[model samples]
Target: MLGSVTTVEGIHYKTKEPVTIHIEHGRIKDIQPIAPDKNNDSLPWIAPGLVDLQINGYYGSDFNTIPIAKGSVENTTRGLWKEGVTSYYPTVITNGDEEIEQALQSIAAACDGDPVSQAGVKGIHLEGPFISPEDGPRGAHDKSYAKAPSWPLFQKWQEAARGRIKIITLSPEWPGTIDFVERCVDQGVTVSIGHTSASAEQIDEAVKAGARMSTHLGNGAHLMLPRHPNYIWEQLSQDGLSACIIADGFHLPESVLKVILRTKGEKTLLVSDAVYLSGMAPGTYDNHIGGRVVLTPEGRLHLAENPGLLAGSAQLLPWGISHLVKNGLAALEEAWDMASVRPSAFMNLPSQNGLTIGAPADLVLFELIEQRMTIVQTYKQGNRVFDLTTSTKE
Candidate 1:
């Protein structure tokens, strides 16, 4: 029940038809549509594995914490497969120069040492020493370490990461941001705007300089803004930029998510932006970054002092996908794509082909019962990784 197989049978995620997907040599070899049997209604839905662009860490592993533990990256990678995530970027946030370098080196070393990490960690997301230092925009990042983007400094981190840093999130508020964005894009790193108070004109300039994404577009900004000239408006207007959002229900309201989805269309992507507390039990937990945080039974992670404030995203892609479907912001197929296929396409990964022959055979089997998505199994590179039928893990 938990071993690798040549083929997987499930209901097609898109067409809702019974299908037999054949896998070989870690790639999809064939996809056969089959006539529905009486038991077809009980089959799980088959979909492409999720690709998360900005996950910080999982369970007890933290990328932001200085001196990442020896096997943390490997542990995080294996933990994610259970959540149906086959590819992901491990996000390292603002910190002291040496701390960031050390963090990168540890992750790079883990990837080099562990086959699972090497395969699952698509890249590292360097989320800042280059973001806005303003109170509201800075979020939980250390303001003392915030500074202008520097290509040479990034190169040092990239070297430490073994050139695994693929996405860099920075604010375009600094004077030379356009040049920095250009440089990052030149090195094949995705330049994303985030944690900013930049003007619309500045955002336009960054986009022109090849900034192609917005990290959690509507968050990490001043709570109040000018009606039409704000950074959010500017990002939404830039057709060249794909917007990643945190759809944990608490991070954004339905109206805003709906608007962004309609505006960006296929450009809309979902990111958990999850913290180490994710996948933990429902209880109050001490967080070094935010003092005290609470993870609710319903999966909402918020500040313990004030329930109104969000601590961080404590859920995975399935929660976000289910939230979208439940809220009527999108149907199940489109919502699933936002968390899986869409991110892969944005990053130009092979999984973008999604349930088609010739793509990487990273796949998931799940069932949606009244908007709760239960991952039944997950396969990475055509090999079964997680099977709920035999797992006793949380």
Candidate 2:
């Protein structure tokens, strides 16, 4: 149980043993197993704070909204903390030049102003404007603003964002993209292939140019395609490219999720790809991008006018991890690694901070009951950022 001190006792994520973690100066001081405390009602499992590489928004706050609402970014970070996410990328999708500029500037200002934003919002994810204009590959992004890749434009956005844009997702089919990828990699920014209709040869060229990841691998493509030589299979076959899957059960079928998990193995990661309506009530709602969309009782978010195509997801990373575990797609430890260890490792960030000494004290205390996960508490840098008892939590 959490007390008035920085030392916390729970089951270690790796060893599955009861242990006590001592924290000092916002870093883990030591981890030692202690005798079982019979008084504890729930044997909460302690794991590294979950990291989400792509999140558009949560609750009623949309990260892409121009002239960002007051406290919107802060509110999103706080809401994610309750869901066990301590680090994430505030994803901005396809939009007009002015809207993208303002959104990135607002994010940079928010991070500069608040400690919570600085701790949780690791960087910005630009997911569009350089993607395919086709219906299936474009997904829900506004095609009017979509265009060929431009290095100068990205530099301007990076300037406005104060160098916080770390990941840029684009289609490799566009001309000059290979050169753009090379430039971005030179600057330490991760380039991911997404929203594309690129052929296998083009995919290989992207990898050669330093594209390190595939953004939401299975979702941003035509529903119907040739079984062979598809982008999904091509990405799956590439050993150098890490793939991020939604895994919320709504984005990809169970069988497909299993194949991607098995194929990618340790290189696989989980991304929410959650839109503005993620935590909102299930009903027909007018969205800025997907127009009229319906959030179902079972948490499926799809276009109301056309139910065939999904608008986005309505779940978070923790929920996705639970779904993977309960469906037998992965063991509990492997599923958790997809959300924490794998993503952090791919991002070049330290992994397993919860169990490592001298690492940041960011962690989540949760329990699995009847295959459902419950987040009991969350600590970021030795501070109690979220607790189950707080009513204003989400």
Candidate 3:
């Protein structure tokens, strides 16, 4: 019955009111403000589930690798639930043409085989094969596969992915970048500038050609640059482009994070950009991107061979949010918005604000205890996908 409901009482994120959210048939039916129920004091704050735009992999599963192990994607989806993420994009980076096609097909197959995986996966983020091939700007992506942007190549990828590729990051300095960006825009795909040494004019032209965002704005670049006229400053000053930051505290310093947050304000998005070792224990491990990466106890992942450069992030989105709050880079609410609201809104997704009637009941219940944010429960479309209390009992 429409009237039959499961009432979820908590402090609402937007109104900051104590309300009982009624759920029926995987949607929020109603939200009625209620007096504080002292008997249910253990309830946590309710907010929109987190959305990550770029997650390469987690727990030893790299999305760019073809022939993924059995249940790898499903396991990764469940791992994300532990941190209150309801929706995310599996990022596919630079690889051989055959490997890239196989990876996309594997992701599509996982979505087809599992309802939960399909629900959590928003789409795919293609992060490479069209970026700068220079050593520093190329970062960890294989140089062999890096090349100029091509429309036909993207069309083939789209066909293999079953049209699930929603975002692509590329360098605007390439020869055919403008035409490719325009075509992607026409097809309702998001274009982000990254891993490039594009001049200010190139950046402006890319924006004019329909680039809407900067992928992990402060990363995938040379270690040093001129104080002015650099790609970073150009993207920051561009009013037409939004920026995504990796707030994991390793990719960017706190001072840089604060500056970007201030400059971009509402346009800033927080992404995990996590790799295969994200959820693994701290240790040295061999990886496909780099020869060897060491996960330090301080939660930093560095190339064991070089030791000067980072491999990728070892933390998820929640840790980034918590790090921002703890380091005073941003307030709790502001950081949460970057992870949950801003990314979805930038992607033109529905229900950017949480707990509205008739919207899917995708919600997260969390609390800040002793300055550490903890996930109490996570729900997707009104189904209890994760519960810390229940999991411990089992």
Candidate 4:
């Protein structure tokens, strides 16, 4: 058995005291608080590795556009590991039936019977084909194929996935959507709302039908709306609903992000709606969504013709955690929770607590030098997957 011991005293689960974590064979063996050690004083904060429930692609791979092969999925999974993402749901949005089936088949093949594959890829998040038809609300999704939820269609997709699809996102206002959400819930699949123009009443009905999450809550809608009585307010006030926000600093302004962190602490999860252009050098690129988008100097994706409209985000989970910390929106611990514990719970994953003995040995170590968080190491099942000190090698 291989093992390593790490003592982190400065920030443990958002606390000030130092905590020592023991790992053996990719499982957390022990966790305890201890007095600071002079030798370990330089070590920075340690926390559970991040989990993102909605990631389209990273490091130049677009889940929707890339041919689903083990090599493609493996490359994408490895790319995410470098960002400290221990686990994520590969989001497949708005695509044709054949394309969706091919993508799902690829993911299942890549994940089957592989340990590292299991570590990062939980399952698929199907995000479209049942969204609103409005141009603005559809938010870059292909409108030609957009349609109302159909039970037969869902059954076909689920069959094509061979039970690998875990979550589905749709607009509740669509005909038969409520029944579809209920059916999906009954079948043990999560249903989330997105690309929607649902009213408060429609949202409530969907919630009652078992839609518990909102997909990228603030990004896929009209820019201006009645301040107090908007979809944002409705989602915020719903106690049972959990939402994900793209904290890449572009999807939502700092002030709005602060408000969300404050009001939805522990209730809100963060996602990188990162596209194919993520992690690539800044330049103009073609979005498979049939439009030209530019990778901004600040690492955000914007529509080439209309800079006001964001194409997607290049930020990963670590950057999101730092955004929360830098803006004072959440305490370091709280930000970590958004990235780790809360998201796991949202997805009903087995390991929801951070660094607890007997939990999966997925962890991230970072130094907060001068208030900037930098990932120093990443561990998956007690084995080092990413070490910034050395180049990434399989």
TM-score of each: 0.98, 0.96, 0.95, 0.93
In candidate 3, stretches whose alpha carbon ends up further than 4 angstroms from where it belongs are 1-5, 37-41
**Candidate 4 versus the native: TM-score?**
0.93
Which lDDT value does model 2 have at 77?
91
- Residues 1-394 of candidate 4: C-alpha lDDT, one tens digit per residue: 1234343233465665677777766678787777667756776677888888888887777788747534666787777766888898888888787887778777777777565676688888999978988877788888887899988878888887778789898998787788888999999999988888888888889998899888888878876777767777888777778888988777889988877767776788988877767778999988767489988788878889999778888888888888888887877788888889898988877558777788887888788865577787777777777777775352
- lDDT, candidate 2, residue 71? 88
Q: Provide the global lDDT of candidate 1 against the true structure.
A: 0.91
**Candidate 1: tens digits of C-alpha lDDT, residues 184-272:** 88989999999998988899999999999999988988888888778889899999999999998988999999999999999999999
- Model 3 C-alpha RMSD vs. true structure (Å) is 2.4
Model 1 TM-score is: 0.98
Global Cα lDDT for candidate 2: 0.88
Q: What local lDDT score does residue 374 receive in model 1, on the 0 to 100 scale?
A: 93
How large is the C-alpha RMSD of every model relative to the true structure? 1.3, 2.0, 2.4, 2.5
Candidates 1 and 3, the one with greater TM-score: 1
lDDT tens string, model 3, 1-394? Answer: 0123377777776666778889999889898888666755666888888999999998888796667677778888988888889999999999988888888888988998999899889899999989999988898888999999888888999999999999999999899789899999999999999999998999999999999999998899998999898999999999899999998888999899989989998999999999989878999998877788899998899999887789888888889989998998888778888998788888877648566898778888888876688888888888878888887897
| Of candidates 4 and 3, the better by TM-score | 3
lDDT of 4 at 68: 55
In candidate 1, where is summed lDDT lowest over 10 consecutive residues?
A: 1-10
Q: Which segments of candidate 2 are over 4 A away from where they belong?
A: 1-4, 37-41, 351-354, 392-394
